[model samples]
Target: MNIFNRFIVTALLVLFTSKAFATSPIITKIERINVNTILVTFDQGIKPVSHFDVPIEGEFSVKLYTSTTYYLGSPNSLIVRTPTAVNPNDNGFATQWQWEEPTLTATDNDGLSEITINLNAYHSDFENDIGHSSLDYINTLNLIWQHDLSITSINTLDTNEGTNLEHTLIASDTAATFSIIENTSGLFSLSGANNATLSFDGTNTDYESTTKSYTVKIKATTGNDTNENTEQTLTVNIKDVTDTAPVIRRFTISQGVNQGRLIIKTDTSVTVYAEASGGSSYTWSSSDFSVIGSGAFVTFIPNADVGTRTIKLKVTIGDYSSERVLKLKLVESHPTDWKDKNNNGINDSKEIGRHNNELLVGENKKITSPINTRLLLGIMSEDTAHLTLAQMKKYRTDNNLSDNTEDTLTTGDIYNYVVENFSATATTQVIIELTSPIPANAILRKYSPATGWANFVINDNNIQSKTSNTCTDDTHWQTGLTTGATCLKLTIKDGSENDTDGDQNNGKGQVNGVVESTISIAIPAASNSNNNNNSGGGCVYNPNAPARFDMGFILLMTLSAYYLIRRRRCFNH
Candidate 1:
């Protein structure tokens, strides 16, 4: 326990601690190229130091320069040693060593000599080889190096270990090879990556009917390396052929009337027939037709007497049958009557029998009672004098009248009594039933062939006269006539020639006579009463005139006063 013993022990403990816990050589700069290659340079200089009382050189050695190599095992290792001997010419000299396994080897054993060696290590295409060769090694004595390393061995490793490597080579040719046997179903598919099923039939001749395309991939592995075998899909297009036959449906027949004519008064019944294919023979039946047959023809007759008639024609074709109906009609003929004798549906009798006796008789028959008598008188006068007695008798017979009736008169009687025996200066009277009131200006005209004269006289006075044979003053003849009142009269006057002397006769002559007869004028119910304003004499009466006075005298006095007043006013003004 003395101080000397303490000094000696402490010195020994310091020496032992220095040897046991030596300072590690710092890697000042370490550059790694890819995953496999690394370059290291030291910063501190080498100094001779003692360990365990032995002389040791300040040499640096790279003991564990670990990297990955494809041909080596896990964590493939590299060890580098540099000698401590200095070159005789330099005082502060550092050694630098570059190493590549199997390419270069170190000769100095002192671990301080400068050495360069090439290691056949794995290299990536992106690594710089020149930078890996120039690295400085300083006083790095026996540097126990530790580094993160990757191993890419030639032998196959587990999936977890090989997944970290950047490059792996696979035995692509020795791996499984897949070829498309057949794409039975025409669809796109991949092998290994995706399996597809095809629906194509191999036995069919149209093997390439549809294009069959597939991807073929090969897999190969050598130890831990893997290679991909890729191939573009091959498309096999199958060609098709025409082998089926064309099909057609059978032909069918339907019967109908092309054109038919039917009489309006007679019955028209027609039969429709039809025929079709797909049968050896056809049996025909119809509800209307009495006859039945086993041929292709079937007929259906319909009873069409009036209006339209339809008959259906049916034909059977194998198990199927079709039907068609035809339409026909029977129209009534045109009617025939007294007005439409031609029967062309038009009343042409009126145009054909214009002015005939039947037409005249029909018009004359329409007149009632007293008018009928007047019309018969007028017609009989024209016919009796111009026709013989037998002719007049025949005319009466045709009109459904007795020839010996009291109304019947002979032509000789009309000529001798009404025309000859009656004086040309004499006048006869005949009464007419009245249906309306007579108009003021109404006149009567009578024809007298015996005297070669016609007379027209006003019908106002009961006593007839042989006036002038003109109707100049009769413009208002239709005025003042009322319904249900006697309205018209006729006065037949003799001419200058007399049947007695056959020449002009004066006052004592048998000519210049008058035949007086009465006629009834019918006023239609729809006629207006104010239309009686028509005046015949062209004279207007003064409003101040007395109502009891004659209209003719008032009109004259008014005209005279108007003239005198106009003259006086002219003088005064």
Candidate 2:
């Protein structure tokens, strides 16, 4: 145990202890340069390695560099570049860099020796720093965490013209809310929980009349964070429905003039036009007769075929076509020839009928058909040369056959007549006189081939005074008719007339140039009231029927006024 031997042994022990336990690199601070980058500082200088790994839950790369250029607290620092940005809402993460003192082939400066750095090695003490040599150590690292919202699964979509479109909105956050921020077309809406559902508005779209496409901007937001919101634009396209059936509507152009019902006359041409929807082309044809032209419109002349014939129209679009058939008739035009079997100043054959027990004269005539049917007709024309009643048919809806003041009644009937060759410039007039007194509210309604029905207003301004006439104002006579005449006279302008068969006129099409007219009467109910028992049997025309003022109503109104006056007086007293 000498002094020299003890000193040497103590020195050796100290040297061995110093070599066995050595201080490792200590991480000091972490700073976030941007959302995708971070700066990491350590207590000691770390070797500049090409590649390394940090215990973090994302994809990133690290660069070891000198710290004096950036004045980061240590001589060794790391610059982390994360192409995938971090979620700001992740709070703080437990991340560290660890290495074992096993196999690192360190070479001299500018040496070509290969360096191996174990980056993914597992260690037990991850939560706490493991103090070791500078070449092998674990250092804790801190990063700024963030949240980012993203919109996904939204793209261009397509739907049929008349159908609705629906799509589920997808976002980075499950609790995110979606809203339509920009929609100029007003055809889209966001609904359902959190507004996560996008849908088309409930409106039927027409391919022919509506906009073809729509563009809208949608935004996704969460947690009341403006920075966490995202926006995207979506497009919706409308597809046409080619299989939709075509619809056909019928119309007629008469004499190359005004549009009206179909005209069927011998040697006179009329045009039939078919207006069809969803049709690219139209073919007008007929098996019974040859059509004059082709396509949407076709003109035809009856010639001598004076009966019903079928006209067919075929509409085609792409590979589909639809056919519709229409029935039309042709009638021969006749000239006016009324014979005077019994000689008189007036034309005898032109007489429609006579007044009760009297013969008509001058322009007045009587219709003497069907036995005991009395009708007086008056014609006022400068030249009645070519005028003729080309056709006349009676519909069994009405009847009025009785002498003066007879109580005979009948349901209303329609009288259709086709007047031919009348002077188109000079207006012709007809005066119809019935012997029996009609109901007070009776009206004469006229029918046109184009428009269905209208009231035939009587013209009293141009009424002609009759000599030796038995009609009177009391009998509902025209103003200048006979004062004591017991008949009702009506004067109206003629309307262009037409009456086709049932198959044609069943609300599909109508023939032009045939005048259809009817008289409607409101028969008085059987009542013992004094108004019904008036001197003329309620046959006067009353435009406004005033309300009756019975004795009870007058007394009640008087009492009500008296009560109001009494109440005012009491209040004043």
Q: Rate the local accuracy (lDDT) of all candidates.
A: 0.31, 0.44
Q: Which segments of model 2 are wrong by more than 4 Å?
A: 1-162, 166-217, 221-271, 276-287, 292-295, 299-304, 307-390, 394-573
Off by over 4 Å in 1: 1-362, 365-437, 445-484, 487-504, 507-573
Number of the top lDDT candidate: 2
For 340-415, candidate 1 gives per-residue lDDT tens digits of 2221111344335322111111211111111111111222222112223454455455445555422211111122
TM-scores, one per candidate? 0.15, 0.27
| True-structure RMSD for candidate 1 | 46.8
Candidate 2 achieves a global lDDT of 0.44
